[model samples]
Target: MLAKGKDATAKVLIVDDEPAFRLLAERFLQQQGYQVVSTASVEEAQQQLGQFDADLILLDLALPPHFDPQHTLNLVPQLASRPVIILTGHAERDLALKAISQGAWDFIAKPIDPDLLAVVVKRAVTKHQLEKELLQLRQATPVSSPLPSLAGHSAHMESIHTLVQRIAPTEVRVLVTGPSGTGKEVISKALHQLSNRADKAFVSVHCGAIPAELLESELFGYVKGAFTGADKDRQGLLKLADGGTLFLDEIGEMPLPMQVKLLRVLQEGSYYPVGGREMQHIDIRLVSATNANLPDLVRQGKFREDLYYRIKGVTMETVALDQRREDIPLLIRFFLEQLKEQQGQAFALETGAMQWFLQKQWPGNVRELKNTLESVAAIAQQGVIRLSDIQLLHLDSQGGGADTEVVDSALLGGLDEQVKALEIRLIQQALQQHGGNKSQAARTLGISRQGLLKKLERYGLSHSSADD
Candidate 1:
């Protein structure tokens, strides 16, 4: 039997045709604290599913008008997200095995014992709830891949692998610095896998993604009645990471106030819940990653220097993909192998496509390259990926400019004409304001110096500005 008051919200659907069994099951489940819904036929089960979100279903193998097993088994796909336990007789063991193949959770022989029914329903509901929670957790902290691996042979990667091997077993905090989408999280997962605490939970929190006002409660959790919707006690990521590793991605984006609280927790190894009077103690290995410059943020007083030093016991820097161009082919091959393993179909790149991939400057680094290949693989004809397949997915035009409008009453023309006039006026003003220095003018106009020069040449104003 399940612990009392734990499954008060879990619902179960009964699809048995027999009225006696349905009532017995429903009453037993309701007494067990689960919301129960009953249906007399597969047809009715489908209708009930539309209105009721069940965590588990008690599915009967045969129905009236058509005592066929396949007829009832057809409902399995409709309840794909829920667990369906098969109801069968002692003589129908073979049919129950068939039901298992049709995706039934397990079989309970009829006439059903109340004790057995209670046990099976409770177990299925508990398992389903746990699975749902894990799914929600994964959605909350979206990772690059379900199974993160550092797959590359670049010199930078080699150094990273060596350093990870040396420090992963220790309790020292690690700070991974790199541009966005360079697989910093993968390195963090690798560290956890290599550590002595590998068997424990590996929790990750994206500091930049969460709102500043809510970050404290999110990390520290809260007790029941702590806030508007705090219905029950919840474990925060720090509490969940006890005896394991906690990865904080985009740590530089964390607010100063949250940083102070986090620093205190690190120093004292204990923290209070958002509304609780008592402090909770925890033990965890910390790993932080960010693309932002911590030193610069500290200099500007945006980040706390003490917190920065506390987090960065050792630093590992990942270079941009362009700096390690040789790893492009290796990464491509690794990604292709993963696709083949996952889809059970081989995918090959055409020579021209391979050459095209090798030549492009991937500003988004490994992530962009992997995504491009995945997209190409999806559209490739006959499992052969071509250059055109990839090219068709990307826009040909590379327009650079913000949607922000310049609020100047002096500019007057059609939309395009007005935009062009505004651009010219802004360029001229910026140039004049900066003493005709093109670089300084470009900075003022929020365009790259090269982009500014291209615009000047296109507008026939190349000679209007003097060089720095």
Candidate 2:
């Protein structure tokens, strides 16, 4: 029998002429927690399937007057996406091979071993679920509202991804440069993930968001009474990130005095905390990012040229969404899947709406694209999504928010299945949102780090394949 925790809702269809055999198979599958349906022949099976959803089919070849596997093979095309496992006592080995060539998922020789049947059924059900996920990703959503994507077939993006794979293993300072929302932070997390230090801390600090007066203390800790507010000792980001990675975002905006201190840490592998007498030493990988042009900053005397060179051991750039237009549809699908968790249904863009999305300049880049998807999913119809649902020309007039109705809530799946699907998708999106930073993803999901790890395993979602 399949392991426990498998979806009890998985439906299996058993087609065999003998009533006793059919009864035995039905009882066996039910014991394994599958919803079972039985039919006596191909004709009855087809009729039953028209009103039932079956994840797997167990079809016996010698049914009724027909005793050929070819008859069952003929129904493969009409069965479409479902998996059909052939049950046969036929003597010809070549016939089994032919059955597989004709699209049978697998062949089980009769008198069927119940354990073997359970194993095949488990795998077939998993395959079907994965297929639905892939299919859901391809469908388009409403005008003005849309969808997720690490999706780009463009050579430029492909080259960037390739570079990430190659550069991730080396110990070097990496500078991620790109426009805001172009995924600079995403690449930073990828670098940390791909590197040998993947299991260690990936501490990130936003340089531009912090006040220069406090930025120094933020990076290099201060001892007790180091400052007016320093009632006790506090470790800086650098100390916290020992033996791991320190990500400095908006590096261009780092204060000159603080830049000198950072450069000292890079050169000496040690640092003096603010007003601290002790020089702490540690091993670390430094990754910095910026949307501003460092060369321009250096030329304008706002940034140190020496520090810029030290930080950019290697440079990578994430292009704007419009720069990789081929990825739009894929991103749309990804976003729709993410939206499904909260909205109870995923929406697709109509032809006119999708064309509009494909043509947009996307100044805000991937972030903007995702926000637009959320906006649209809020107002989309439950049935086939169309242009009018989002009120494309007048988006502001439309209530594209959580107030949106769930038109086809029941169409998605059973409540337990839906919850599991949502949990899986939410995990994926959260991982993407944090660039595979599990700690950050856990924080975003309001769960403990270990709890998130268990869930990731349960869903077969891996940190290594987060980008994929």
Candidate 3:
């Protein structure tokens, strides 16, 4: 029946041996706008409970021939914060009191009352949700007054935080490059938040998602009747970000014409709206990011060289998940805490699950990890998230080969020489793909700009060559 209501859609699990009783209970619950799952025995209930979170458990106290109520009561604490209600045909007052004393939330008389059952179920779910919300608030609310520093014990993350702090106060055009899901946007936002212009707006634009035809208008805006659908005057992202910061994601995808326009905006600090007679001036700080090679695009004439130089006044790059595999454990703990707060479940990953998560070659990077955690959290039972709980949505082990092959092929030489050769090849490939943008090249290689610079120094490949 699964009726639709904002708060009435909590999940309910009904465990009873009587087929008729189960059917009637399920139907009544469905009509009340709840998601109902029924099982004939405690064993079946336990199995199903491991994979689905139940807001309330409706337990029939009279089990089959060999079943004991005490055995069932032992499993109650296993569920993550879920409340259970007892159901039985026994009319004795002492029996009901015993059941309630054994940790049942409420006892319902068998041959259930449909209307009364619905009201009790709704009240139990409401109470559970309120308690969960209060717990989350207590966990999330900070005790200290000062804003917490963006600190990471990992050397790689520590370096990034240091770089963010150093570059935040300046108006330098920063180019942040990283593989997909490597937290480039997080770093960018942190840069904006810690900067001198923190009081102003921070506008984010995904360059790849916009169609090329509308990108110009979206960036620079348009006057009324500028095009067939343009009925009203529009303010562009650039104008909206005036006296603030504009974050350009997937900057490598910006078409050459738009690159020229972006270059002009950076150079002149002004732009004219489409079909508008006047030029508008804006004060803005630009932060750009990409996961592609920009230098190669430049070599292919797909990117503007002048624009690359202008936007990369200062540069940073994020390390890939594979390169910093040691951080996976820390990340997993952080995500689990977040999921506990978000889903109202105090679930811990099983040892096998933790090992599986650590061993995965996360090509999709941090985003893949978060998604995996979310999936596991949704299906876990007994407050234990097991390896079987996660359904691996995608396998991207193939992408790790290029970097590995490059390293292995160069290992015959001295460490310095091998590293140099590997650096040269990666730089060439990245530059050729990205059109002479070092930031973009570094992203494709899964290394920071400073790391890329160190590699460049080892290979005797100058910054001037990357710009070319």
Q: Candidate 2, which ten residues in sequence have the lowest lDDT sum?
A: 405-414
Residue 293, candidate 2: Cα error in Å is 1.6
Q: Give the poorly placed runs of model 2, Cα more than 4 Å off.
A: 1-149, 340-347, 350-352, 381-386, 392-468
The segments of candidate 3 whose C-alpha lies over 4 angstroms from its true place after superposition are 1-152, 344-347, 391-468
Q: Between the candidate structures 1 and 2, which one is better when assessed by lDDT?
A: 1
For candidate 1, list the clashing residue pairs, or say none: none
lDDT tens digits, residue span 18-114, model 3: 8888777877777777788888878888888787577789987667655666556555434424556777665433343344333345556656666
* Candidate No. with top lDDT: 1
Query: Candidate 3: deviation at residue 434, Å?
Result: 61
All candidates' lDDT scores?
0.75, 0.70, 0.70
Deviating ranges (above 4 Å) for candidate 1: 1-148, 395-468
TM-score of each: 0.54, 0.52, 0.54
lDDT of 2 at 462: 70
Ranking of all predicted structures according to lDDT, beginning with the best and ending with the worst: 1, 2, 3
Q: What value of lDDT does candidate 2 attain over all alpha carbons? A: 0.70
TM-score of 3: 0.54
> Against the correct fold, how does model 2 do in TM-score?
0.52
